[model samples]
Target: MSDVNLATIDLNLLNVVATVLAERSATKAAVKLYVTQSAVSNAMKRAREVFGDPLVVRESYGLTPTTRGAELLPALRAWLEEARRLVAKAPVFDPRTSTRTFTVACSDAVAIALLQPVLRLLKKWAPSTRLRLLTLDRLIAGDGLARGEVDLLIGIPPVMPPGLEAELVYRDPLECIVRRDHPQVRSKLTLSLYASLPHVDLALFGDIDDTIDRALARHGKAREVAVALPHFSSIPLAVLETDCVATISSRIARAFAARMPLKVLEPPLALEPIEIRQVWHRRSETDAAVGFLRSLVREAAG
Candidate 1:
C-alpha cells in the first residue's frame, strides 16, 4: 500500500463520514445534511474510493460499521469538533435561559445521595437546564464516557478508563448497616460478631465480592454472605426483612436511615475509605455547557 498523507485529503469528506457514522443511514444523513439522498450516496462512494474501505454496510436495522469505520469514528468526530470550535463563534451558555440537557451516568447510591441536592441547585441557578440521570452498569462507565453517550460519570475513580479526566468530589468512609431493631445493634460489633452476622452483599460489576473478601482476609475472617444484589438501594429493604448486615458508603447508609428503620455502625475493622469522583471525557473539558454542569455537581457534592 502507498503511504498516503492525510494532510492532502479533503476535510469536507471527514464531515460526511462522521455524519454517516452518526446517522448510520445515507437517507438519515441526507436529511440531516439537507442534501439529496443521491448526494449522500455519492459522498459515501467517494469516501470508500478515497479510504479504500467500505466504511458502513447495511444491517438488519440500518447500518453497521466495519472495522475500519469503527476505528475512524472517534478520531474523525474529535477532529471535526475541534475544527468547528476553532472557526465557529462561541455561544455563551446561559443556563438560566437556555433549555439544555445534561446526561449523567452513575451508580444508584450516588444518584440517591447527590442528585436531589444537584437538582435543587440547578433549579435555583440554572432553572431552564434539564437533567437526566442514567443508572450505569459499572462495567460500561468508561465506554459510555469515551463514546460520548454520557456527559458525566460520578463514582469511585481508578475505575475510569485512561484518557478520561476525573475530579475528587468527596471522600466518604465505609460503614456497616443493619436493622435498627436487630439484636446485634445493642452491642459493639467485634470482628468476630461482624463476620458471624449474615451479610447482604452488593456486587457492582460483579467485583464487590472480591473487594470485601480481600478486606476480610486482612483480619483472617470471611463474611457469610446470605444475599447478594447489584444495587445499594435494595440493601435497606433486604436488611429490614432479614437478619443481615450490609457494608455500604456512609453517605448512602445515612441517607437510607433517614427514611428507613436502619442502624449505622462503625465497622469494627479498619477499611479503606471510598473517594467519589466526577469523571468526563476530555472533549467536554472546555465546553461551556459541560463546564457549568461540572461546577454544579462539585457544589452539590460539597
Candidate 2:
C-alpha cells in the first residue's frame, strides 16, 4: 500500500520474504537460498520498512511472522503455485484445436481392440488432429521413428526396431470365450473337450507363424479350427451366436463379453501373455502434438 514506485522495488524480494516465513529463521532461509544470513536480514528489514510492519519478530528460539506477514502468507503461497504451473505447461500444444496429423501403424487386431476408445479420446482432446492408420501389410522399417512415416504403432511385433520409443499399452493373457448357451460347454472346459470343439481361428496378424498353436502342439494337443476369420472383431460375434469357441486375448475377450452374451473361461493351456505397445519414432520426441496424442493413447488404453 506504499506510494513508492513499483519499478524501484525488486519483485524477487517477495521470494525472500516467503522463504523466511517458511523457514521461520533467517539462518535457515540463507542456507536454502545459498546467500548469507546478513543478506536475508537486510532484505527482511527493508521489507518491514516498506510494509510499515515488523514482518518477523525475534522469538527466544527463532522468528515468527507478525500479523501482516501472517495475513500475506496465503496469497504468497497461491501466487507461487500459479507461477509454477504457468512456467511448467507446454507453450506450443493446445489439444482442443490442434491440426497436427499422424500416421499410426498397427494390425487389424489392435484396431478392433483399441480403435473405439482411442477415437473417443480424440474427440474429447485433439478434436482437429488427424489420425491415419496403417495396417500390418504396410508397416516397414526406415528412418528413426521420430523422423519416419509411422508416427505410432500399437501391436505385438517380432521386433521393436531400435531408435523408437515404446511402452506397454496393455497386457492381455489368453482366455477362451463361448456363447452363454453353448451346449458342449455346460461347465468347466477340460483339455479333451477343448480339443473336441470346433474353434474360430483368426488368420490375421500372421497367426500361421505365431506361437499359440505351436505351443499347443508342443503339449500334444490341438483344436479343430472349423471357422477362420480375418480379425478378432468378427470372431467374438461368431462365438456369441454359435457353438464355435474362440481363444482370444483377455483384453478383447473381456471387452466383447462386457456387452455380448458370452462367458470368459480360463484356458487349459498355459498361454503366453499378449503384449500391446504404444510405439513412436524417437524423431517425434519433441513434437508437442505427437506427445499429446501419445498421452491420449495411454489414457484410453488404461
Candidate 3:
C-alpha cells in the first residue's frame, strides 16, 4: 500500500469518484453533478492518481469499474451519503399534496387483483400520488429492484439478485380453476380426473412450469395443454371457453370467480403454497416516501 496520508486526500475528489461509480459514465456523472464532461474527466484523472488504480474502463455504452474500483465503491458511497445527509438540506414529503410518482413492478394479475384498493386509498389520503406499473417478467423484477429502476416489486419469491431485500406480502395456495358449469367440475376432481382433463397452462416468468410438471410426472400423468398463455388473466377465459382446467393462485381465481363464471377447486396433489413478496433495493429501505408506499401495498394486499 502507498503511504499516502488520509489528510492529503481531497474530499471533493471522492464525490466525483462516487458519482462516476454510481453512473458508470463520465458524461452521465457530469450531467448529474451539473459539471462539464471535461471537468469530470479531469477529476477522474486525479482520482486515478490518488487511488493508484485505473478505476474505470470504457465499455460498450459507458464505463465499468475495475476490481479495485469495485472494492472502493461501497465504502465511498456510504461515506458520501452520510456526509450529504448531515450537511445537505432535506426535502419534506407532503403526501396529501406532493405530486410524486412511484414505480412498481408486478404482473398483470397482481395489478388487477391488488391495485384497486391501493388506488382508492391513494385517492382519499394522498390525492397527488401517482403510480406507474411495470410488467414483471422473467428475472427482470429482481434486476429492476436492485438497480432502483422500480421502487418496489410484488410477486413470487424465487432467488433474488444481490442488493435487494424481499418481504413476504401474502400467501395463497394454488387451486384448480374451471368453468362454473364444466362437466368434470360437477364432481369433486380426483387425481385421475384432474390429470385426464385438458389444461390451460399459465407460465409466469417461465418458472412454475418445472415444479408443476414434476408434480404431474410423479403421479404418472401429464396435462394436455389446450392453451398456453403468458399471464394468469387469460387462463380463466381459456378455461371458460374450452374444456380446460387451470392451476392458478387462489387470490386470482377467487377474484375472477366473483365476476366471471368460474369455479375454484382444491388441487389433487399436495403442492407447495405460493408466497408472494414485495422487494426493493436496500438504498431505498430507509426513505420515508418508500416506507409509506410499502405500507400502502401491505394494507391494500391485506
Which one is best on lDDT?
A: 1
Q: If ranked by lDDT, best first, what sequence of candidates would result?
A: 1, 3, 2
Which regions of candidate 3 deviate over 4 angstroms?
1-86, 138-142, 206-208
lDDT by residue (tens digit), candidate 1, 230-291: 88888899999998999888999999989998889999988888988889999988788889
RMSD of 1: 13.6
Across residues 94-206, which tens digit of lDDT does each residue of candidate 2 receive? 88878878788887678767789999988887789888888766666443354577778788766766777788888888899999999889667888788778888777744
Worst 10 residues of 2 by lDDT: 138-147
Tens digit of lDDT per residue, candidate 3, span 1-302?
54768898877999999899989999899999999999999999999999889999999988999999999999999998899799986577778987889999888878877889989988987899899998876338356776677898888756777788889888888888889899767747898889899989876655447677789899888877777888877888888898899888888889899989888899999889888889888999778788888888899989
Query: TM-score of predicted model 2?
Result: 0.62
Better of 1 and 2 by TM-score: 1
Q: RMSD in angstroms, candidate 3?
A: 13.9
- 203 Cα displacement, candidate 3 (Å): 2.4
Off by over 4 Å in 2: 1-91, 141-147, 205-210, 240-242
